[model samples]
Target chain A: MILVIGGAASGKLDYVKSLGYSDSSISDGFIGEEPVVYNLQALVAKDPEKAPGYYDELVGKEIVICDEVGSGIIPATREMRDAREATGRLCNRLAISADSVIRLVSGIPVKIK
Target chain B: MDFLLTGGAACGKSTYAEKLVLGFPKPRFYVAAMRPYGEESFIRIKRHRKMRAEKGFETIEKQTDVDEIELPPHSTVLLECICNLVDNVMFDDQGNMYDVTDRIISEVLTLKSRAENLIVVTNDVGSEYSDYSAGVKAYVQAIGDINIALAQSFENVYELVCGIPVVLKGELR
Candidate 1:
């Protein structure tokens, strides 16, 4: 499994695509061959409980891309904060078993294993 | 063993640091830098405290003056954040960036000396180009400088990318 992470507009998806995984292989919502779970935070926002199960199924199988959305000023609303924390927790779980983890800073990939 | 953990907000720096400290010997201390300023901060503090509970950690709440705090001999300490300490020291006073950065670096060095192992947590807030006010920009600069100094001094530095620990300086144990 490979995990790709970066902030907004950090070109995480482009970096993953450069690795040879085409658009057809990457799945935005459903799990598939080379599933690219871009914006994992959105899944948490929609259903926090189901998010972890989705991550569990993707371990060692999917290529994940997510924004580092936890930073900046703390959110005012409770729902937003919950979503942020849930996203962070889910990422931690995914990273522990991931074969490789890459961080993209301004479209540059830095390997973090 | 000195460890420096940094990442964007909510990237799981705190959770990873907490896990790292457990690898060392007992008498662990969690040095919390954030104050309960308002509702959001209070919620964060509560969550962090809950996370640390029953983890064999003794929590020490200090905004600044970290060097002045007494630690048990040969104990491991986790500084929950460096940016909050910077804010506490620089928020009221209009000090120059160099002085503030130096102050923080000095304090971190002192703490490092006192503890057998120090796990320092910091946020990467300067990565993005922002239209924030002058004060915020200065704050970001201070954090960036302090991170560099600490990373150079500490044996290990890990940047958490969406909860994934990426080692930039030294290996993680």
Candidate 2:
């Protein structure tokens, strides 16, 4: 699996597409059931009970993309804060197993793994 | 070695900080500044941090007056998230507001001098441009100024991207 993470407008999707994965192959992590998963952050935020290990199913099989959270002012609400912190913790296991890890900064793809 | 680690929320600053400290000798100290307020939030955040909880280290809570913290010589220290410390010191026990930049910087420096490796994890809250109130604006500015000053003092500085350390000042060990 390939893990792609960056802030908003970092061109994560474009970088993934540049790797030859079609839009059809990519799935919305919140709704779609496709092979490549995007928005893993939202999916985890939607369900606070789900752990990072929950994504173990995608190991070596899906392309994951998410927006980096938790860097700014702590959220005003409790729910939002929990979701923000959960995004990083829940993805730890998947990050370790990812075949390739990419971070998009200013629309430029920087390979971390 | 002193490190100033800056990264977006949940970009794995604590995880990376732990990795850096684990490389050093024993007697690791985790200086956390988060003050528990919301029960639900605490439980949820606790669940998230469980991964790092059991790691070999001693936990210390230094919400304010960090200069008062004392540690054994040659120990490694990881102070997770300065945003909380700034908030704590700014709003005292009576919830009064004041400028805490210089006090925080000086106190943190004092704390750094006591450790062999001081890995300070801080947030990057200056990116979003919003019409925040005077108090919010002041808080954000204080954090930014502290980050800039600390980055200059720390030997190694990094901004984590997706949990990966991106060198901003010195080379990774």
Candidate 3:
């Protein structure tokens, strides 16, 4: 699993695609909904026994790309907070399971794991 | 309550949210929705993460589905972008659009109903050109509708232009 971090137009998606994953497989254009949970579940459904082993899947078969979103402030509203919390927790879980982590800046790549 | 920050591409919605997080005294978790789909994007994501890590910011990377995770009530969360989240959900299972949308909305609402504070980032794709492919048009429309609904639910809504935050609804203070 690879945790990719960057702001808008940071080219995170393009980086993942360069690693050789199909556009459909590695794309993250969820228009109006929360996608991390569903994407994780889809990965789990692929292999129930290895569902929790997201890291294992990334070892050789493919690179799991995740967005980094911790550069901002907390929203004053409750719902916004919840979404942030949920997204943070999911990223943390994946990071813990990931073999490597990377951060992007102005289209630049830096290894952090 | 839900707080929706929507704007055009490169409008600085993510940056504004980041600024907000920096103001909080407590530890804040940044939820990133970006993925490296190609070599160019890969480098970009890596560089950004490096910058945040240097600043001592702890991050979480999630692509889709948020209901199964465990979150801290005391910590504030910033959901970088809803557009990617929606794409992940829609692509997961094309036939399950209704179920996926409903589930996402419910989960988002649930998060707001339980968290101390939440900030959501999304794109205002509706204000741009609308004469793309049919599928693309539908996708844009769906996202537009979702953004509107999110704004309705959120108490604080802002639209960014040239990196400036124009308050659309509710006061931040």
Candidate 4:
């Protein structure tokens, strides 16, 4: 029930490790079990349609990491736009349900919840 | 009272502002400050309108000259953003940068005085370290300047990070 989010390579993993999550417990996406730290962005990118279900399962247990990909200039291509929208929607859902939300900026963790 | 909401792009400032406005007394107005001059802007404006379509907000599209908008006294008003208002006043109308910040301050003060609750939404445009065009840089500076002024003037100022509100000034309530 923790959401760790930031821009690409903003040290999301380092912070997750700081929390003592084992590497083996982490995952790129869900596979019927909650990873110690799940990369929510990768799962959304792999199949945007599965994001809602992943979120449903990960809502109250998994520690999720998602990249902040919706900021800056809006995308011109429909595909990129869809990806951005999907990421934003999923993050918003997690933000609401997660007990804690942390935003990493330059390896610094700023607690938002 | 005035409430200022600021955050990076797509960081849920608008949605947060919407929720704030909803908590106040009605005759709620959403003051949109973007001109649909190009394809991208047109798409953005349409999307914004659709987002607030069900929020019981009577949309007022005014890119600049916010002081010109007519509102009933004691109504809650949400100025969608200050960044776009500065952009419209500067690049869109070729307004001088030196005076743009002052003008926005005056307009915002005027708007604030006219409402029971004024929630101003703005972006944290200068936080990014990327280089931008001269015009874009000027716009960023203008927004930063106005945001500082707003932070001082408003009783409540908040910055959203990943959809969580951080109070910079007054209490959230």
Candidate 5:
């Protein structure tokens, strides 16, 4: 899966849509429950050996879009830190599996694998 | 938190995203959702990649199910274009439209919750003319709902008009 990162108004969504994707396929925050979120965390909590099924379940999905939280300094609250840590781990894992990666700025796309 | 960028077509969303990514101190991943199914698509993808040279991005072409992929931590993820990805997946097989929509939404939310810095690119389809095919209408409605959900979930949301960003939430400057 691929992840997208950019600042506000950077055209990240437009670029994805231009590639023929609808809004549903790009954002990670849908109206209802999402399977990947639960599965990934479960796997991390239980370890790969205990959650082999979860590990096998997430192979070869296309272009997973994630919002970037690294643009500024770290959060002060513990809950925020935990959220950031989870997000950081998730992005790192997806990046390694992704065939390529892209970054955007001022509505322009930059390819970084 | 998630970052969402929405705007009209040809409003320079891609260009803006490239600049932001370039500003990062470390290298990041650039995910291009365009498949280039025809000559026109291929040319367009080529042009986009070429224009992004200044940002030093590596391009990955994705054309598969998005639900089964895994992401790494601490890395920047850029997804260029959400509309096309939905179109490709929704019609991939002779599947029911509702099923496709459900899967798409689920996958997107999953990605957002799991990724580090997820940058999303999508167009503002709600403001366009309403006269369209039945299928097109359904797609637009579905996408509108999805966009609203994304905006609500993300900490940062921006609307681009005439190549300029009008921040709707969070601190962007």
Candidate 6:
């Protein structure tokens, strides 16, 4: 699977569209049969440990966009910390197995892998 | 020469910066900007030492006022995590509440002049949507502005993600 990761509002959606992913091919995470999933943090936050299995169920032929929530200061609440930690772990896993990994910074996409 | 290495928390920027320093000459200096103030910081400082253990780095703890620091000639220096230093300087016990970006940058340039290569590690902490306090917002603005200014000064800039380096301003050496 291709992983497009960036911070919130960093234009992951636009980059995916630039890659020729049409609107019909994009879904919000585990809701549609679309090949591209955006805002994947919502899914991973549910169960970060199981996120790898969930992504694997996509058959490794999909494109996923995950917002990076791990670069800022330590969160105030335990729940927020858990969520960010989960996102970090899941993103690392996806990056390792991704066919290509791209990080978007203010709308510019940098190929990382 | 100056290089700025940036990334989010646990993104391997420190490890990569260490590798870059290793590629430079001896008398490598690691100017740790994080102060050993609280429990969390103490743990972090120890962990950082463990990360750079046996790596031949003469670590110097300069939690604030880096502009006054002087370094040996022909040495490679790494200033790890500049955001902490900004906090120590801006939000001190005296609470002067002044923007110290220009002074900090000038001091950093002074240190740069003393070293052969200065590699700095900063954070990408400007995208959160939640409303923070006036001080937190000001701190964020300060660091964000400082990153932009430093990027202009540094010859090479890199951002790390998932232990991988993405060239930002210049080609990786």
TM-score of chain B of each: 0.94, 0.92, 0.85, 0.90, 0.86, 0.94
TM value for model 1? 0.81
lDDT of 4 by residue, B22-139 (tens): 8987789998887666665686678777878877888887888999888887799999788778767675345454548999999999999898999999877665446677866766
Q: Top TM-score: which candidate number?
A: 2
By DockQ, rank the candidates, best first: 2, 1, 6, 4, 3, 5
RMSD of 2: 2.7
Which CAPRI level is candidate 2? medium
Question: On residues A1-113, what C-alpha lDDT tens digit does candidate 4 reach at each position?
Answer: 88998887899989998988877878665544546546666667777766677666777566888887765544557666666667777788789888899989899998889
Could you tell me how far off, in angstroms, the CA of residue A11 lies in candidate 1 after the best superposition?
A: 3.7
RMSD of each: 3.6, 2.7, 16.8, 3.4, 22.4, 3.9
| Candidate 4, pairs of clashing residues | none
Find the candidate with the highest lDDT and give its number. Answer: 1
Number of clashing residue pairs in every model? 2, 5, 74, 0, 90, 1
Query: What TM-score would candidate 4 get against the native?
Result: 0.82
What tens-digit string does per-residue lDDT give for candidate 6 at A6-105? 8888899999998898998988866367888888888777766666666565436578888888776668865666677667756766777888898888
DockQ for candidate 3: 0.02
Please give the lDDT score for candidate 1. Answer: 0.81
Give the least accurate 10-residue stretch of model 4 chain A, judged by summed lDDT.
Answer: A29-38
True contacts kept of each: 0.54, 0.60, 0.00, 0.27, 0.00, 0.40
The residue-by-residue lDDT of candidate 5 on B1-173, one tens digit each, is 45788865444567667766666644466777776765646766887889777666666566545545566665566777777777776654665565355666676677776666767887666553336766667777777877787777778887653245668888674
What TM-score does each prediction get for chain A alone?
0.89, 0.88, 0.62, 0.88, 0.66, 0.87
Between candidates 2 and 4, name the one with more favorable lDDT: 2
| Per-residue lDDT over B1-173 for candidate 3, one digit per residue giving the tens place of the 0 to 100 score | 34688755434566567777666645577777776565645764775576466444568787766554467666667776777777776654445443345556666666666556788888765543235766556667667777777788889998653344557899864
Off by more than 4 A, model 2: A29-33, A51-53, B40-56, B93-95
Model 2 Cα lDDT, one tens digit per residue, A10-113 = 89999888889888988776535677788877788787667455566667456888877766677777678778877876555667788878888899988887
TM-score per model over all chains: 0.81, 0.87, 0.55, 0.82, 0.55, 0.78
Best by DockQ: 2
Clashing pairs in 2: A52-A90, A69-B9, A70-B9, A71-B8, A71-B9
Off by over 4 Å in 1: A25-34, A42-61, A71-84, A97-99, A105-109, B93-99
Q: Can you write out model 6's per-residue Cα lDDT over B1-173, one digit (the tens) per residue?
A: 78998877766678788889999888898998886766656766887799789989999888877767777778899998778778777876776687888877887777777889999999988756768888888888888888999999989999878667888888887
